[model samples]
Target: MSLERTAVRQRAEAVLRRLAGDQARLREDQWRAIEALVIDRRRVLCVQRTGWGKSAVYFVATALLRERDAAAQRDAAAQRDAAGPAGPTVIVSPLLALMRNQVDAAARAGIRARTINSANLDEWDEITAEIHAGTVDVLLISPERLNNPDFRDGVLPKLAATTGLLVVDEAHCVSDWGHDFRPDYRRLRTFLGKLPERTPVLATTATANARVTQDVAEQLGTEPAAPAAPRPDVLVLRGSLDRESLRLGVLDLPSPAHRLGWLADHLDRLPGSGIIYTLTVAAATETAEFLRSRGWAVAAYTGQAEDADRRAAEQDLLDNKIKALVATSALGMGFDKPDLGFVVHLGAPPSPIAYYQQVGRAGRAVEHAEVLLLPGAEDAAIWRYFASLAFPPEEQVRAVLAVLRTDRPLSTQALEPLVDLRRARLELMLKVLDVDGAVRRVRGGWLATGEPWLYDGARLRRVAAARATEQQAMIEYAATAGCRMRYLRECLDDAEAVDCGRCDRCAEALFTPEVSPTALTVAQTFLGRPGVQIAPKKLWPTGLESVGVPLKGRIAPTEQALPGRAVGRLSDLGWGGRLRGLVGEGTPDGEVPDEVAAAVIEVLKAWAHGDDRWPSRPAGVVAVDSRSHPMLVGSLAERIATVGRLPLLGRVSSAGSAGADGPRGNSAQRVRTLHGTLTVPESLAGALAGLAGPVLLVDDLVDSGWTMTMAARELRRAGAQAVLPLALALAA
Candidate 1:
């Protein structure tokens, strides 16, 4: 055998020895898989569960590649005047914490390595240059950074030019079937296509099923080096859902007060280390403030936070300066802290995948950590609110495609008017489209780079299947009569369940009670009803009423109540004073009864007559009105509904409340009874001219009819009739 090959074998043997000493040896299947990888000179994709030694395979592979590359450099030098640059293996990881951990491991092994991410791009560039110049041996990078044009076109080309091997950690992300799907991963296929044919790629992931494995292979443009094996035996634990130490319980109270109460209770109890996962940035900020008010050191992390602030907050968490953190999912992916003892979810995540990833942040040290999912009916409402935002409307996606089809670089400022996407979400979507070859990034922005495409039948089928799978998982979580942990494991992968003795069902055998056959039959029948709204109370037999159903048989009342009531209420309240005719304006004596007059006034004032005013109505009211309205509500209802549908706005405390002058509440400012007055003529003139100035105008309601009429009349008189009106709230 060649001397370099012998050295590589020795290093591999040493790694096996060390890992075996720690009682973590690779199984026979794993070893055979690795052998096949090396022998066939083909790519390998290893998918195993958490705690399985997926990393060990790649660590050994990296060592072997390094040695091989080194020997090749020496051979090239003998033929030439001097040694050429050493093209070390490139590892693309999604998590910075994982990157750092790998760097630390390499350091312990006396292997020279460096990590490049958002944290240290300059240093990354310098290290990459050194790698090109034959100094650095291993280069680790987050997939996000690697997908950047500068890195892909500049640094990666140099690495590929040198015949470098590419290793993708957390490779499941490449698959739409994976729990944490990233759009950037699709671009890796393009990167792979650019590499030399013989340049082997290796992917390692802790979680992947059959479909995910297939996706990974397709994305990397290669077949597996060996046949897939059964799931690993890594002592999978189905831990208790009932965290006794956590004081777990649902809070149905108002958000601000309940969140504040939670912050106060735990801020001083934990080891200055906790995370509060919120559904939005605003909530993160508000929760952070609530904790801070309790005299605890805290920080907020979300998409809205500046990069510097986010970095500072992360550093503080690492340094143990901030005892608690309030954040959205944007903060947790790459952060690591083994000593963190608590993770409190302020709301339910949209899917089990999201919930697993977020909650997985805790208990890294195998300590008795606590995770509390404080979900009430409102939490369900919050998730439904987010789900609507996460999945954009068909028209929005079509508009995006239209904008991209212009064959010109569309700047962010220019594209803002075309779609209802947030800056971050839009950027992510654009990147996804770019990776799919549907669009391309040009000098200043983006342009259409592919054929005009509609959703294909196959793609639609795939989406429907995936959505069904997700919905199945959600239903299981919601209604399963077993340990939550066991249910989650079975849903994720149909692995054998280990009895978690601490869970709610296991500890108390609460789910063992046989459901009444009659009740079950009735429930099944009711569930099968096509369109009828069957109340829970209607399910019981007439003579069985004495059994005493819980909570008046209300299933998720808070989430369902408003929608149920709004339909009937809005119609009765009148489409602009129409319902007021039902109740006489004055009593028989010519003086109106207080209740009668109040009811009449409410019916008149509740009617929303304009675009800006619709948000003041209850959740789902706009949708109901659109369906029931006489006018073709097309796109206008969508636009008005779109504003109320925004996730941040939906979660805001004041959602659905009318403006200052609505019937639900009296005007905070006196309404001008006279309509023909101009409060500030210069300000109005500036507004009408579209100048950069604030203007004040008087109106009874910022609703469709009144505000538009008033603004139109005033601006027409000013001879500038095309002015836009802004308002805080509107009457519906």
Candidate 2:
């Protein structure tokens, strides 16, 4: 109880030792940040490179701050009241993996840390009680939790009033202009303003350009709306954003199969266990499967993986029990394994800033690590697909605002058909609006604030332009002949950008270009042996009745199309690349390629004998009229009919002008777009009027599947016994 300032410093040093053993000592920047937060109570923004001990600053500062508080209270002769809080540190992190790692690390430092996230819903009440009882020393939470109705209105105020330190990990997400911006992070302003005077706030990020740094700094100084509080002057500590340990390189493979072949042969030669990052979940899955088939110990990780599975995979990787985790961006941020020796990107991310953040995960505590980019020709198409899902257009935002009423809460399900955005995008827009005070997500869903919100068109355009610039920068990085590491640093606006002499471009090529013939054959076989089941839609999308469709609840068994087949997915690692050139978002419609035809034949051959085979072979083949891919669909139908020895029935034609153009929309909107657009041709109707066997319905692809659904229904209504749908690819 009589502890002095010097005593607190010694205790901090001891805590650090406990976490990292005798080798633990704070870096100058870490000590500076800790002293500023604990002594000066000033807001600090640390924009250093990854593996720079950013987490250590917060954990050490938390220990010092709490001890400092208790010592002052004791000296003042103020006994702790029953209701007085333990003055815990609240850390708003970006991912569950981050939270898990932080919580475990904190316990090692003798600092009690707990987390409340989607993964621990069953323990929310228990965690809440612990917080109220002043038992938690540090609380880690996801950004999304800050906007929850019960959390925002009921729990946050108490937590803020008692919080001694606020740490914003991955704080670049606070700025709209940041590469990985999230609107939920902007809600931190409200939380910050509610804190007691002079509460220390620390924000840290590994990826931020000069523009993003300034933007986040400004937001760090923003106060909440009412009874304005004084903003704390932020102390910015930006170090050289370079990893001396990384040896960067670019490997431009000619084709997807070759890339997989390269990985199959070379994965064993890469330094140590690290992450193999892919741009999509399907790619991660397919890559992991290929690697496993080739005798590599690996596991696939994505946002779709269960929480327990992710935890197990993370542990396995940490223990060096596996070769690597084939993962998407899901396994990113706060996954700490000091000896992680390499990071290989299957496809380039959209920006050099993102690439820097990802590759930095390697060589944290080692002298050397390998960072390689296997950029694909299809990278641009994948980029464009994700760009489509960015912040909605201004009109779409206004439309969402128009539907929310002050008196009622409408769940996302209830709002889908009423708006054009899909559920994910719709929910994202709502969170952005919620942070802007234009709407609020409540128990059931969301409600309007009746506030006059400006469109900020100019700002949105600036962000859009910035994205395009970043994308071009990434492409340039992939092709640049200069220092690969330096080019990335320059893109991040690092003031200390210099040639990393360790890179392939800086020295001689570090990796060989040749892939073994056996490896290539194996990769091709895995890629070509393709068949993906097109799961049939069962329940109708809610609010379809409001869209003038008069449909809701279960889709009648007869109305639904039977399970179908596709050659592959647009996001698959192997067939995906070739399929993209033929059926990607902007690719012009064309006849099926000979290669694709052969693959389709293989699919048919397998279907005729595979377990999911149809009850009987089709008696006839029919084409679904496609406004975009008519030739492709017609040719596919003719080829299938000829090969299967079935009659070529006439194609179904569009009877109405209605069509859902552009990339796919929400389910209800897609269904509405094609509900009455298709009609059975008189010739096709007559041919199918007495058909007794299933009809093979051919199309270029199935995106929303509404086209196939509608076509199949029309065929059934025309008297076909059953419909069998087949296509070249399933849009990811």
Q: Which candidate is the best by lDDT?
A: 2
Cα deviation of 411, candidate 1, in Å:
2.9
TM-score of 2: 0.95
Query: How many residue-pair clashes does candidate 1 contain?
Result: 6
Candidate 2: segments with Cα more than 4 A from true spot: 1-7, 72-86, 224-230, 657-662, 681-686
Candidate with the greatest TM-score versus the true structure: 2
Cα deviation in Å at residue 201, candidate 1? Answer: 2.8
| Clash pairs (backbone) in predicted model 2 | none
Worst 10 residues of 1 by lDDT: 562-571
Model 1 C-alpha lDDT per residue in residues 1-732, reported as the tens digit of each score: 667445545667676655434544556545544553443345667655443455566666666656656676568654353222246767887766567767766665456778778878568657867887776666887767755667767777777655455778777788767767777877677666555544566777655555666677666653222235222112111222322232222233333344456446544544447788877664566567655655778898887777777768877886779887788878655366656766777766656656655666665554455555654334444443344333344576667788777756876644654555655557767777777677777666788776655645466457556755675575456555666666555545535545455555455421222234443443333222211111111111111122221212322321121111111111111111222222112212122233333332232233344232222333221111111111222222333334445211110011122122222111111112112232324543443453222121212223223323333334434434222222212322
Alpha carbon lDDT of each predicted model: 0.50, 0.85
lDDT of 2 by residue, 1-732 (tens): 235446656766787888878988877787778777876778899999998889888988888777666665676554453123348999999998899889988988888999988878898899889988877889999899998888878888888898878999999899988878999999898888877777788999999999999988887876632355566799999999889999999898888789899999998889889999999999899999999999999999999989899989999999999999999998878889999999999999999988998998899988999999999887887888788787788888888888896488889988888888887888888888998899988899999999999888899888889999999999899889899888989988898999989899999988976899999998988887878888777787888887789878887777667888999998887788778778766678777788788888888888889988977888898887777777787888888878878899988787553322335578888778777788898999999887878888887778877778778888888888888888888987
RMSD of each: 16.6, 2.7
